[model samples]
Target: MKRTTFSLLVVDDDEDDRMIIDDAFLEIGYAGQVKKFMNGKMLFDYLEQIDPSFYPSLIVLDNTLPKMGAEDILTLLKESPAYQSIPVVVYTTSLSPSRQEKLLQKGVYACYQKGEVMEKVIELAKQLRELAESNSPKE
Candidate 1:
């Protein structure tokens, strides 16, 4: 099957993690854009500036951030009519079961623990690529 190109927005405080994710996608030869933000504020700012038609196909959010945590960012996205339909996947180093449930209840598409190995991250990148392609506009 042919794959459709799409854009993904990732918000994570850790620069190394972001680089790893980007590299993983590249390793898979994902034919889409991967934009990274350091925090929720930067993500929101970019969102605000983009045309609605140009909005990202998916958003990957880190559960913990220096300012404006994942929950806050998720709430805002869910509340916004323009952003509500975009899928959000939460990535975290560690999460309690209750917290994961809470994030799901708030409308995140999925929650995944950060992988310890590069291979694991590559697997995650593949999943993310599939999701982005699935969400892409049908031609």
Candidate 2:
């Protein structure tokens, strides 16, 4: 299999969750950068400051954030052509089918329930890796 280097942005308020995600990715041997933000506001601030070419290959967003929630961020991203192409995957602990449908309608790449087990997290990391690799620009 070909290896691709890409950047992933994670927006979640929970410190433990972020650390777990980082560990999971590391355990999976993902050869990429993972930039994490505490909330959507921080994410937007980073986005504004970075060059467009350096935008993250994927954004893993938690539905419940401190300042701005995932729904609001999704709206803003969809409205802006410059950031619309970046795929966003919503990771949340409580998501109803209706909520998932709504998120999908709003243009999220995928919505996954936050898992309790380490194996589940690793699986999510692997899935995210595949999604990021598929969306990454070809050389």
Candidate 3:
């Protein structure tokens, strides 16, 4: 079950990408808090320090992150007892099948290529919302 208000954690270094994600969420009328991190270091720090009960409903991660790459971060998250259940969606410009397979193997919920078109991005956001909602903790 989901909380009354959902929360989202997004890790991306690109300012434009962040804005687009925010806009997409807003456009979809997502009633959630969208936290942004410009680097993997900060994101990791935040994750490690947060109380387990307050973990985000979902994590939207980029394949290429500053400070740490997706593989390392995903590994850490999956290995951690507190964060392994948190769904992670890979949102990146890299559209490699092997890369997607690798992330899927690493336990990512889904992988999506960042879109250049607004409509497509919005659609992705809608899909993400559904994925996150599905994974929400049971109340």
Top model number, lDDT: 1
Better of 1 and 2 by TM-score: 1
Off by over 4 Å in 3: 1-6
Candidate 3 has an lDDT of: 0.85
Tens digit per residue, CA lDDT, model 2, 45-76: 98998778777789999999866899999999
Model 3: per-residue Cα lDDT over 21-70, one tens digit each = 88998999983567888877888788778677878888889999866888
Tens-digit per-residue lDDT, 33-125, candidate 1: 888899999999988987787788899999999879999999999999999999999989999999999999999999998999999999999
Q: What is the Cα-based TM-score of model 2?
A: 0.92
lDDT of each: 0.89, 0.87, 0.85
- Pull out the clashing pairs in model 1: none
Query: Candidate 1 vs candidate 2: which has greater lDDT?
Result: 1
Q: What are the runs in model 2 whose C-alpha is more than 4 Å off?
A: 1-6
Per the 3 Å backbone cut-off, how many clashing residue pairs does candidate 3 have? 2
Candidate ranking under TM-score, highest first, comes to 1, 2, 3
Query: Which run of 10 residues does model 1 get worst, by summed lDDT?
Result: 1-10
- Cα RMSD to native, each candidate? 3.8, 3.8, 3.0
lDDT, model 1: 0.89
Name the best candidate (by TM-score).
1
